[model samples]
Target chain A: MLNPVIEMVDLTKKYRSFTAVDCLNLTVGKGEIFGLLGPNGAGKSTAILMMLGLTEPTSGMVSVCGINSTRNPIEVKRKVGYLPEEVGFYDNPTGMENLLYTARLNSIPESEAKKRAEELIERVGMAEAKHKKTGKYSRGMRQRLGLADVLIKKPEVIILDEPTSGIDPQGVRDFLQLIVSLKQEQGLTILFSSHNLHQVQQVCDRVGIFVKGKLQSVGDIESLSKQLFTESLCLIEAGIHEFPAENTDTKPVRKLLEPINGIAKIEHKKGVFEIECTSDLSATIAQTIVNAGYGLNFLNKKEYGLDEIYNRYFEGGIQHG
Target chain B: MKEGYNMVKKKVSEDTTGNQKKVKRPAKEKPKHPFWVIVNKEVSDHVRSWRFIILVALIALTCLGSMYTALNNMGDALKSSKTGELFFFLKLFTVSDNTLPPFFVFISFLGPLLGISLGFDTINSEQNRGTLSRVMAQPIYRDYILNAKFTASMIVISVLFFALGFLVMGLGLIAVGIPPTAEEFLRVIFFIVLSIFYVALWLNLSILFSVRIRQAATSALAGISVWLFFSIFFNMIVDLIAKGLAPSSFAPEYVIVKFQKMILNLMRISPAQLYSEATTTLLMPSVRSTGPLTMEQVAGAIPSPLPLGQSLLVVWPQVTGLIAVTILLFALAYVAFMRKEIRSS
Candidate 1:
């Protein structure tokens, strides 16, 4: 059992009367990519700030690599690499110079720092433009340089806040691929926050959904859907040529399905009927439909994706709040 | 199953301990202090900036102009044997003709500009450029950045002043054909140090404004406004207030003296006033005291120039007052900066 590399115990932050992050408890295991999914103003950035010890928490504790963040921020900072949302660099310095400054701040030896800076520049694919001042770089290039900047220190746990916020689809894909490759090559634990559901679903091993400063749920898509729905859904698309148009003609099918235990909802759309029931009731519903002489042309179970799960939890959170 | 679980647990514990050891291995080579890193960066940045160049050029040109005029006047005074020849080297800095004020007086008036120009945008520009939080995120304490900025700027200011002082001394030596005596050299050094301290007060004040105000232009305006109020209008305002309180003309002799003291005390609040008074006392040893002396107090005193030690004694309170205000302003700026949120806009 690997211990979690990052842990937050009942962390909370309040600005006057309004709470930014409510008593949140989170633990991220070693070498795992955890996604913090939320809409804008969902306390993800605030939580990241507290974890980095850049902002003081109103209450509770944060620890990185078993060291208390507030008690010894410099030690934790040494092990954590943060690529902030919309990252910026000194405009007057070249990309190489910027990285060298960061390297010097981390106290790497001058020769070693220069070597690593050159390697990182090439690795991040900015070698051709390494000598150009950063003010002239495009957004995509800047973000890539930002990644190189963070990697210069070789931190164990990397935290990126909205690393793909303003990039095009192709840029985002390339950037995320680089991130994943870094994780694989260095065995680094990554925690990235983004509101893009597709991106989160594509990269994260597990995810935590937050709404209104509250954690709605946390799990992989399958587990989250299982926990939320607590039942199975089977859609039977039948092309019945002799389908009855009157409501009275479907009474027998409705009666048969209503009598069965675990069957919750049955709705007819077009020539298909959707049956919501417990996991084991799908077979029974299919058998009864075919035995009733209805043309059961196609039947399939609908898999819930993260979008549906996120919407369900998001709406649930709003009502509960 | 139970045996397997125990074996896995033991392996995991060993792995974690091994990783911890690997992390600690680099601790043998200690890193440079973050303070010096920031200082080096800041000093280099300042030296390369156009603002420093322009200000240095401005000071140099004005000082040379004043030196030329003073040199001509000193030649005439030497030939006529009218002005006393003691501390003639020091006269290059303080002597004036019909055309220009002395070099020391020019510095007293323009020194605040150097301090303000360097510091007005120090913190605010970093914040605006979105570099403050990134720099703060490094493995260093929060106050290191602020301390480094102050220290680096002070060092630059000291270097600039000392260089200019030496230049003036060399020019004076070539023209006057006389080396400064030991007393004169020490007095000039003291005067230079005092000038640095005075400018530092303004530097700290502008830094305070920079930390509080987010816009670089606004902070610069605020710093200059305060300077103008002190340099241009503050004395007039103090005189008006003193007259309203004591009405020096209608009051008795002691009342008039009291009003005069009140005015002097009020003017001392300005760093510029304190600087000028202290420098005047240090460079012109003929000056005895800051306050006006009564007839009985001056009755038994000789009019001869005081020595270096007594001149320092005469200006010691003003010097301390300047230092106290500088520290106070710096403390305010430090507290404001440390408490400020390091969020990028």
Candidate 2:
């Protein structure tokens, strides 16, 4: 990492007999968007709480902005804005009032607190509803105010635990875009925790897959795919104009392509042929099919996305030891 | 040095606001102390709450009603009194018609409710609203929340007690056509102070329960249950125990006297007992002792009304007892709240 803003070293949190977060080691660099991806009960929230010093770890250390969270929680909290899962505000107070209360708690002077609150409410698209009581807001509206609340303190790092859990799909996209822009514009290091795989893939510069109170893997998508899927190699697909099995030429087309280097197996599905290979054999396979006078329409290589990786690792059990 | 963050944030906001800075105060004003900020917020929150309004109305109406009753019967009270009481101003609080209780009696009954109402939900309601953890995540220390809460409620209770006390004294001035002597004025002030501590005891108990119980309703119920236990059944239970160990009525006279003293000490464990004992001594000048005195001890005591200092000395133990229990319960709340996990669950 270029410059780690958040570092968790052997951090563990146990509740009597059961551990909520196991020994976890991870580092998120400056201005990086790191997604803490996990299932519902995978200790993602617990780890976030420990990082914000809202919960004490059973052992080891977690730090933010070079400050040990347990030892100097108030200082850590001052620099890191944490929006917990199912984040809530004082229901009786208007959204603006809640933000002001937070700003006051942070010791922001009255006039400055108001100015920041207004700008943030506008930034998070909560300007129209800022005057409304939070109890009357929908789930999506509450999330918007929550984001504004986090930004009011002008924190160096933002930790949002499941910020999009209850929002509509379009709102989630906009929220993700806002945070990414925030990272770019203000140079903020954001630690976003979510169970949403596709969304995490969309925004995070790197991802950490946590499972059953343990982190299974942490890296960018391409790096994680390369690290976890090297044994299975890659999948290649080719389409030819006359590729259906009803045509008697299909067998000849299949027999003609057996000489390609690194080709592992072939499966015919409808009109497309799936060529499994141990390497990037798209070039060789395309050349042979064209050389055999078969008009190929399309050829493509399959890359592992987060969903596929999650399914593979989750199904196989994350703990190999 | 960390406090400078607020100044930097102010500059950032000033840039954002441009020409819209409406505040006339100097931009370089120091940040208000966070502890006082929280206390102010809590006090205003309580004052605005519906429960607070209802409590004020309830206590105020009962106070006026009891004062009216006292004024209506004051002539007869002055005529029938053997000591020929001159401090009629004090009578507004102590003299009650058969149909109604005095100001002190109403305080003994309603003061606990006031404390319980203000504080039963102080912790759990914030936790339930999901604001506690969010507020705790701020730069303030953990204990600030609990301490600010206790201080704010104490402020409210004190203001309410002093306001009502002075209002009665003011009205008593108009009704009786004579101002209270300095000693009478001091006695009323002492009575208000004692009532405040009496309420403080219950406030601490309720705040303690608020920290221990997760549900606001359950904490409120727990506080009310304890209040009811002390005010009603606790004395009866003490009586039953005393009867069980009554020295058989055949033991030595000293043994019987010691047994009686033990039972009185046991009854004082109830906060209501302590409050009433302290209140009676503070409000009434002629009343001398909270505990029984022997013939020789009473014989030397003149029938004259005790001075303000002497009265306070008499009520000192009950006052100290009330304050000690209040502080002890507050300590329990403070420790529990500090150790509590800030997770929303």
Candidate 3:
């Protein structure tokens, strides 16, 4: 197995009594897309910053590609690409100029840096806007340019905070696709935090959920879904309310059935009863209802996407171990 | 399940052991970037700024306007005598070489403006834009950042001072039909050095202020406030103090001499005052009466204006003091900046 490319071992950061990042132990394998999900003040940013060695950890350690980050930050930086949320540019410079300067900072050779910059700008869909002065660029365009600048280095680890924030839906999709492609094509390890839960869900292989400066849970999407949220739901509509138990051995004739398993609860309102059950029971339960009832008007299993999963942690007040 | 757990433990150990044999990657081979890359960046950023260009142009116009007026009036005096015209233009153009001691008036008027313009936003803007953190994140030494800023400001101040020197010299040449003597050149150089120090004092103040105040606007305002107090209100306080402490003799000559001495001593407390005095002494060779004093009262009160070297020696303590103060301020800025927490946005 490949060694983890990024590691934070019991990393803690404290500012006075406020613990920004509390004993975070995280690892990113050589080619994993790891999402750090949290709301505001969850210390997602603080964790990434400590990992970058931009902020010193009060105690513990961070390493990038096996190099101790704190003791050798510049060396670690060489292998990392960072895109800060709300990125600021030398406003007077053009987009190309900003990219070139960042390339220089990363110690990329001038000729190679220029070529790489062009390629990144093209890849990030900023090729047409590259010549415009940064001050004149809109926020979305500036973000694209920022991403392009980070990609100019082709770093082994890419750490981005809210890479999709403030962007239109189309732009978000495009940016996520670009990140996915980078990971797939280059074997880049990504450690990105975003408020966009759906985007994280679609791309990330594993996620670390944070709340109130602590990691609430860390696992693959399926496990987190099963462990944290197992309430399967179904929407069913019936022509008659009579069933075998209610109608004295007279079952309402029905057809057009789908399968379900275990039904946990049923709520009837406006002639439609919503069924909630454990995982793998929705299809079996739905089929049972439709075959027994007179007319199955609607029978569909409900899939709670990332928005619900995100709220389960944020609103449920889960604590970190 | 037990076997899987054991396998996981073995993998963890293998990883930890692999970490133990950590091999240091060879430092990437990078060519030496010439010092000029940084210098060019600094110079281009500053010189291209609208603030710098507007400031230089406005100052030049103001100084030249006043000096032209002064010379025109002096030209009237020249109509009566050849000696008067020559003396008039010399006093007007060569501020540091005037017999009548006009250097104080010129420098006191110009020094603060030059100083504030050179340093008002040097550190604050970088901090606000978050570039300071990015620049420091590189492998370069900490001192390089501070020294580079100081050097860039110094270069700019040097360029402005010497450029003014050339402008005045050219005008003098056209008016007098003779270029400056070598001694005159030496005097100008001394004056320029004092001017640089004067600017450095402001830069130092601004840098310190920038660190203390998070906002660039606040730093600039604070710098201007310091300049205003020193240049405008300092002398008024000196006069009030002198009036309150007058001796019983009440002789105007003796009183004036005593007053002049008190004024000089009070001005010594302010760097701007020390700089203006230095410029005056460098320019004037016969400022025997520093105040409205009779010859008898000032019998030994005033010394003959010393040569350029002695004038420098005279002000060397003040210059050294200001430089020390500047370094101290810069050190404080460095410490403050280094300790600041740079959070990702």
Strongest candidate by lDDT: 2
User: Candidate 2 — what's its lDDT?
Assistant: 0.88
TM accuracy, model 3: 0.82
Model 2 agreement with the true structure over A70-187: per-residue lDDT tens digits: 9999999999888877778877889999999899888898879999999999999988888999999999888889889988999999999899988999999999999999999999
Pick by TM-score: which candidate is best?
A: 2
Write one digit per residue (lDDT tens) for candidate 3, span B1-345: 999999998996677575453442223235335244455567778799888888788667755655565455554545654333323434554342233324336655666666666676766677677566555444454455556776787788789878876777677667656556576677777777777777777777777777677777888899898888887788788878877877666566656676667767777777776666566666553443233456667677544444556666666666777777767777887787666666423
Question: How many Å off is the CA of A231 in candidate 3?
Answer: 7.2
Off by over 4 Å in 2: A237-258, A269-272, A286-300, A319-321, B1-24, B247-252
TM-score of 1: 0.87
Runs of candidate 3 with Cα error greater than 4 angstroms are A230-261, A269-271, A319-321, B1-38, B66-108, B126-147, B250-263, B286-305
Candidate 1's DockQ is: 0.37
Better of 2 and 3 by TM-score: 2
TM-score preference between candidates 1 and 3, better one = 1
Predicted candidate 2 versus true structure: per-residue lDDT over B1-345, tens digit per residue: 667998998887877574555463465556788899899889988999999999999999999999999999999889987788666678889898779999899999999999999999988888877788778778888889999999999999999999999999999888888899998998998899888888988999999999999999999999999989988899889989988988976788778778888988999999899888888888888889988777777887778888889999998998999999999999999999888877776
TM-score of 2: 0.92
**Can you give the DockQ of every candidate in the order shown?**
0.37, 0.62, 0.14
Q: Ten consecutive residues with minimal summed lDDT in candidate 3 chain A?
A: A250-259
How closely does chain A match the true chain A in each prediction, as TM-score? 0.84, 0.94, 0.88
TM-score of chain B of 1: 0.88
Candidate 1 residues A1-321, lDDT tens each? Answer: 277999999999999999989999999999889999999899998998888898889999999999988788999889998888778888878999999898888988776888999999999899999999998988899899989988999999999889898899999999999988988898899998999888988889889998878887888877877777765533334333344444336556678788888777777666456677766466777787788787666667766677877787776543322
